[model samples]
Target: MLAVELNGDAVRAKNGSMVAYDGRMGFKRLTGGGEGLRGMVTRRVTGEHMTVMEVKGQGTCYFADRASNINLVRLGGEKLYVEASNLLCTEEGLRTGTTFTGLRGAAEGNGLFTTTVHGTGWAALMSDGPAVILRVAPGLPLTVDPGAYVAHTGELKQQFVSGVTWRTAIGEGSGEGVQLRFEGSGTVYVQPSERTTLGGQL
Candidate 1:
């Protein structure tokens, strides 16, 4: 997993269980909280204990368990925006900016990251399993299966290549069918899993 901070230092959860610190003062939780959309809707639809927990800070924090190979880079003081497809569920509203899309089956305003963090900016991501950080030197340019590619910088343009198109047309998803080519020097994290899961933050 790659964890880069925009400003202050980010501490990992002591046990490192797909966790992150809200960078807040300690507050006792009276009860456990359910996360993601299910939890939020429950607040409105059922009027149950909708509120999960509270943090006493103004910065964004994140975490990813397992999928260890990582490449975290600071992008000034700005938050790196991502697609919900790229977003695993986050603490409450961290999945904002993930606009609605037809491919994923959501309509509108249905994700995380409602607000932006000011001083401290960072991107934390995980790999499906042990990953290989390939170096695209002069001769040996790295070409990986698209699924293996996780979060690369927005600067990288996506190129769709053919050779396995038939599989995806029928929804078979040829394991190595399509690949997003990164043509620059920015860091790209790749996990070992063929499924190449970016943990849905549920």
Candidate 2:
């Protein structure tokens, strides 16, 4: 099978559902249950319904039929999130967390979540994926703001560390150093260009 990609960034997702998506999204249609279906589905029957662009070379796809929007959040290093807003389905191998728990004072921005991959596996996010991917190696350092990351893979751990606040203070706000931190070795895929959700700004 090829890497999953959605023509548009959105499809529908249900409770207990999961799928990899790409590009921006439009309206998502639902089935018998709605948001209240989580108890019944347990994130199983949901994933993004792809548009035309993302499925150009792909076929035999998976889809989630309940979720509305999902975004790819970028944290520094190997950290990223399949943002709840833009998230369709995540694999059972990875871990997810709220972006606020780590730092209350700083790193307090909207449109960000925290996720980490434990082992080497594949996870898909909504985007046309940059034509090229950034390969992370020892001595090669990369830092992405919370709102800039898409998805990452390989052996890695995500920690909310002391960067969000310090970085925020640099501008003229309170000092709270809480950022989604990734420490380990891996690769991160980010689209130099991204699509903002409803507000149109990340």
Count of steric clashes across candidates, in order? 12, 35
Top candidate on lDDT is 2
Which residue window of length 10 is worst by lDDT in model 2? 47-56
Candidate 1, which ten residues in sequence have the lowest lDDT sum?
99-108
Error of 2 at 54 (Å): 21
- TM-scores of all models? 0.43, 0.38
RMSD of each: 9.5, 10.6
Tens digits of lDDT, candidate 1, 89-194: 2332232222222211121122322211112333344455654655444333456664565544433333444445565557676445444455544445566765
Q: Candidate 2 residues 39-147, lDDT tens each?
A: 2243333322111111222233445434323333333334443434334443323333333223311233332323332222334455443323566666555554334
Off by over 4 Å in 1: 1-54, 57-72, 77-96, 99-120, 130-142, 165-175, 196-202
Best by TM-score: 1
What Cα-based lDDT does every candidate model obtain? 0.38, 0.38
Score residue 136 of candidate 2 by CA lDDT: 64
For model 2 the TM-score comes to 0.38
Residue 19 Cα positional deviation in candidate 1, in Å, after optimal superposition: 6.0
